[model samples]
Target chain A: MDSTPEFVRLWTSHQAEIRRYLFLVVPRARDAEEVLQDVSVRLWEKWDQYDPNRPFVPWAIRFAYLEALKWRQRQAREKLVFSDALLVQLDASYEEEVPFLEARRRALQGCLRKLGDNERRWLWLRYGGHGAVKAEAVESGKKLRKVYYALEKIRVLLLDCVAGTLKQEGWSDA
Target chain B: MLKKTSRLDVLLGRAAEEMLSPEEATELEEILTRDPEARKRYLQYLDLHAELEESFQLHAVAGGLGSVFFPGVSGWRLWTGAAACAACGMLFASVAWAYATPVIQKAQRRTIFTENFEDRLAHQPTGLPRAPGAWSGDDASVVGAENGVLPKTGNSMLRFLRSTHAEENTPKSAWCDIYRLVELSTPPALGSRLSLSASFAVAPASDGEQFDIYVGLNALDTYPVQAPDLDTARNLSNTTLGRRLPATRNGKWHELSVDTQVSPQTRYVLVHLAMLRRVPGPSPSHVQFAGHYVDDIKLDLLPSNALPVKTP
Candidate 1:
């Protein structure tokens, strides 16, 4: 806890992951940052709450979930808005990404290199934003379905490459 | 099982992005409970989704945005950022695993509540001397078993409208949401009048009638404590009465304020604006009826009885 340098380092390394976790949990971009900041502050204040032995992701998730709930509650009282069903839906949607991010990223790097330039760009465009796809589809004069299928094929190729790399990396257990 | 796992993976991906159908979601939940390995795989997949999201973060754009694999960049920066994020992660992990005590947890929970209160206040409408957005229908029938006024039932400030017609179809006196009644532990000191300086949109129904605004003490009075009606309410020299602003072209925000006098007797003083429509007229459908998007409302509560006015 005394090591400010260590804390800053930790924040840098996991900031992306924390941001990702918050993005999954929060609907708005701004809210995700707020959650991340709140989580960081809470982590700082309650440094004693952490056990050095455990993984950080789960703990961060717990904090993120708590923040998300508080966000919901605030929305409820101030706006007196949101139906129970919508709340349930939002909760269900928030944290669906707990398990495979690291391995997949590791796997994806090897496969992403194998893609053709166009395919890589296609992947980037498809995953970029809905606007990107709409723009690309119009420019290419291609049906949305065709663009979707092409993207899916590229994703499958990448997944296959990743799986092959994992095998080479001795992840036979997976 | 493999087929089920495959389907789970696809559904899980969609679910991470909140594009899953209801039926697919139900299946996914069932798989989560019954299959541990599948659940593990799903969690791993969620991590991937997180990575994808992080890749586009603004901070990720540091050192000139381009591809993740930009050439001529010092490897040290990557290592440093990685080390920093990892250290932050570990510090957080240590705190969560080691130091979290029950006493600390309770205190943290209270702090969370307080912060939540402040954060929420940013978007909440201020209550009047009585309370902002208080229901004013007749409540003499529900007499209290104890001292003070019997608590009002139904038509609570927080209510879920079943449909647009729920208000009209429902009984006029129906309490929309129930409030938790609490007896004050000590003498309830009069809170100072909140200096209201915020915009509130007031869109009347198609009939062009406006919602009524009031400042009053308690809920039983047929009229407001300060302003009996709109014209009278507007004419008060000392009061902070505002003319209703026009609707936004694409729903622009509005602001209003009231720095009224408050006293210990002002147990229930308030400034309220009701979105009322003419009988058989166009109903101000939804929250838009009150002529404003009341969400993301902010209120600053002043110290109690800090009114500048000298009461006679």
Candidate 2:
């Protein structure tokens, strides 16, 4: 029996979640993506060994965690965001919060639409790409503090809105 | 203490923006280790940043490429043959261009009319006391809100004036209306949705009277010579009035809008901005229009049929 078909379906569907988990453990986004590529290849090769009874994500995430740890060792000491011990502890906590995080991510899409036009633009410039926010601030002659203040307000609003939506849908108190 | 709270907040903000230095990163890790609450806050901010980064990233989906691809290369070296690489690249580009010809068109919003009251001289040509296309009714002028708080866009807005205009509203009106007219040379195609959006603002004393505000639209072949009684009298079958709700007294600009399909017969659209209770002190009137204003009126047309799009 070819496990490639089922494995491909599962991997593609949950690739973003795995990438997000890797981002939490890996400090740099590019580093996370590099580790993610290796993990994908590793998972593909080991698909036949995966036990179908257990949850696919928790099983696959373990591989990602180990791969990220290896990548962190290859990086310069200054690049690591946390110590190895702290990363390991946080990985366990993140594994339990996967479902809740998925819910919050979905709610965030709706909350994004509720933001004002300026907030959306600022958010895109700040996070959409490297150095985009600084370029915009300099070109527009806006104070850096004012830009950060607007972004902070938007984050708080989205967090509150996401919490309210989750409550309304009986997702969680958060 | 606010000092400690602000410390965690600033660190989280720096992390989310990808601006944290190595030193700050160490501080952040120590704080997260010492304070569980700080750790939770860090997770929330990181989660938001991660999702945002996901959305910002390029999403390229290439379908049906597996069968057409050449066999996987072994120990590929880009500099091995530059001339051959250029030829191969051209071939791939041509093939991809032909295969990707079928594109999905994007939905569009066409702006028909937009006014922020910055330019007040553009009045509708009307031959009546007050009509839909022209700024009708009494005691309303475009003035800038002091302290720059009320106007939706620019500094200027249309304020409902109460100077000797209370007597005029009583005869046949319950609204002080400002009019804007958009005349279409040809009626919009069927199934096209005409959307009207306008922002209203008000600032009143806590004990001040309540003033009602409404937005109305009329789609007709021609403008009425005389201004129609917008609230009290039954309007023509083609009229649509927004709900008569009390203006919020929170000193914020609130947006109100009305959207309806433009039938094949609609030649002109009359946008009406009306406010009620514009008189002074007691008796027939309770709350007077203290700082009731309207600004930033816009008209948009969304075509249902697939249209040409420059953006997706």
Candidate 3:
């Protein structure tokens, strides 16, 4: 019952993976973050139930999945949301992408540095400042369509850069 | 030259922004099902979006990543800026530490037992009886939520009161000793350090009322009968380790943390919160006064390295 040290180690090691898994399951980042907190509490409460013989990531992911489902039920009235089947499909794909996503996260700083000054500023306005695309457009005196397109372009560039960096570092999907 | 925007790219962008309509979502699903390349690209874009969002949150918590990503800043200036940022970060962290030291200190120690007196009242019946997890002296009555003293954090607090009725020349002591047994799975070994802490407030009705609060650890099997006097309670065989706290007549909540050595043959520690009152009377009316209001009682077993080094 006194598994504090073991639980801390397991939780610290799998926190990022849990967060990413919740993010994939839940649509909104806020909802995903809330579910992450729930998952943390649930993990602590059920720490004694965890089997040391098995891998911790999958065990943690099961808790994350349950919490995400609970969150989805709470937000059932929201629009454009995925069904349980679709979520299961996404979760399956997410499990496969966890390793690659970690590498991409590592390469993100370099990729962000490679962005153009204007692109970086736009990114700051949108993601960094947490301003919406419309807000960015209003702030920069650009049309909403133009802001959206610009952001889309910047995202594509970042994605391409991350892929290139990973490939250069000899990271392949296979 | 800029590459033309593909349908998949447009769908991915809308999906990232959560702006995809039902029609667009259906089309995107069709594309994802039909083309493996589109599905791969979609997952990658989603992953990138999540990474960027998470990075922003991380940067915000780390006091912003502005200095590291400033455009056109040269080597010396960057180093200087980084150093300045580091200095600012240190300053900000120090201030945060000052505000969060108590919470950080509590979080660092492993809690062996904690009772906030929040849930105990709800489980108690209507009459003034002992709390669910607490055992009180014969003279003590645990006031339930209805007439209970207001809690520091939760809905109720452990209100210990003793009333003395002395006829002419009889000088008697009124005391309330409340203790709860905290069964530990891995009990502290002999000579191991432990800490007992609780916030208490005394509300003496008159100047003649004297309040004494004692917090301590006792062995599980050793049950000590409630003693009428403070000296008798202190010298009890069950009380392996304890400290008598100073009276707080100001009526403000004062926190008392006592460090003591763990005794042998202790599978569980009894966290005792005793409120003793010595009332000297030559009065016409019965003297009534509240002894102590206790809340947030906690006991922690300190790690060996956390113990204070004794100087020779």
Candidate 4:
């Protein structure tokens, strides 16, 4: 049986987990995403060996961590943001923590909906707005610090809401 | 609220932006290495950071006018006009990042433009067939965010006030639409394709004629504004790709997206988002609009060989 369809189905469901796993090990967005691409190719080449009974992410994430370390090695002249010991330590335990991460991600949607006009505008300015936004902010007579502080406040609100929402939804361990 | 921000949280925030100093990075690793609780907080914050970025990615070019998000169509044009005096083409960096990727490397996907109806300052449609080409709609079309009307995403959304829009000085009630003018002087990639996606929300359900929503991506030889007057309906008819949204009575947002290959000779692309009243005969009601809403308009340019991302 050609597992192409099955591989595509399982890969679609678990790719985000792998992206998140790589994010923890590789701090740079472009580099982390690069490692993700490499890991994706590696996974597809090896999908014939994947066992349905075994958890997909935990099995797949090992490849992401390995490629991430290779990226780290290429930049070894500089001090590493995340040490190898930490990445290895994380690989062993990340599978247990994914549920809470996913729960938080779900809770964020509801929290975003709860934002007021000003709160939403601040998030849009800091995150969704374009690259020259800092200079634009200054030129428009709005303080960059004001936007940063406002963003920090909003993130706290979102994180708190996530925790509360999960608890209310009976995710006690979250 | 959490009492005082932790040292770990401060460090992680900087880390998300890739701004952490070498010393700060080492310290961050030490804390995560020693404390189990700290490690948990690190993962949660990093997860939050990534999720927030991804959500914004869906809304990357909300209110963007080929460059940055403009509060209103005119205000942004004025601001960019004045800003461009200092640095020409600096503002038009909407087409930034054109890295060469072979057809097979799909991970390098990037959003080229978006128009989430976040602009509240416009009373009439903003981009009405200009020499450069921009957004165009009816005098009745406006950004709505009042009377308990909620957008699918962002603070505001495009609301059709009436069932008719003026084209060539004649009011046409066949469909009410908002047009996004995409003028790409050069093809993004030789084999790349363009993806247009949008969300439409339902108003009151009707019995007489079913109202359908569609998003149109049409590649044109000349820019929309450069086209002679009486532009819209003529260009829309030459659509290269049209995607009809799924019919739903649930009163929720319906997402529709389409991908089309842009010919190398293509120069300008007109994106049409409309609510159509396809009844055999005209009725008294403004059925073309039928009170539906549009939001979260996004356009992405993907390499020709781009495919769904493979993962572990």
Question: How do the residues B195-264 of candidate 4 rate in per-residue lDDT, one tens digit apiece?
Answer: 8999877654547545557787766666533444333323332235555532343356767778866666
Q: Model 2: number of clashes? A: 1
Candidate 3, fnat value? Answer: 0.23
In terms of TM-score, how similar is model 2 to the real structure? 0.45
Estimate, for each residue in A65-153, the C-alpha lDDT of model 3 and write its tens digit: 88877877777776566666666666667655654565577678888887777777667556645444455477569998788888898
Candidate 3, position A13, lDDT:
53
lDDT of 2 by residue, B86-106 (tens): 324433432343224424455
* DockQ top scorer: 4
| Deviation of model 1 at A78, angstroms | 17
Candidate 2 per-residue C-alpha lDDT over A71-133 given as tens digits, one digit per residue, 9 for 90 to 100: 767764665457777677668667444445755777888887776656766765665424556
True contacts kept of 2: 0.18
Stretch of 10 with least lDDT, candidate 4 chain B:
B95-104
lDDT of each: 0.39, 0.61, 0.60, 0.62
Error of 1 at B283 (Å): 67
Q: Per-residue lDDT tens digits of candidate 3, residues B1-312?
A: 335577889988988887789888778767766565665677788878888876654543333344335333223322232333332454344333322221222213678777776665422211112222455432334443432235666766777654332112224434444566566667565556678998877653446555556675554433344322322222232335445544545456666667755555556565666565533423343334444677778888775444222222
lDDT of 1 by residue, B158-227 (tens): 2112112321332332111111111111222354443433332322234433332221112121235442
Instruction: Choose the strongest candidate by lDDT.
Output: 4
| Listed models, DockQ each | 0.05, 0.08, 0.10, 0.14
- Candidate 4, clashing residue pairs? B103-B305, B127-B135, B127-B136, B130-B225
What range of 10 consecutive residues in model 1 chain A has the weakest lDDT sum?
A: A93-102
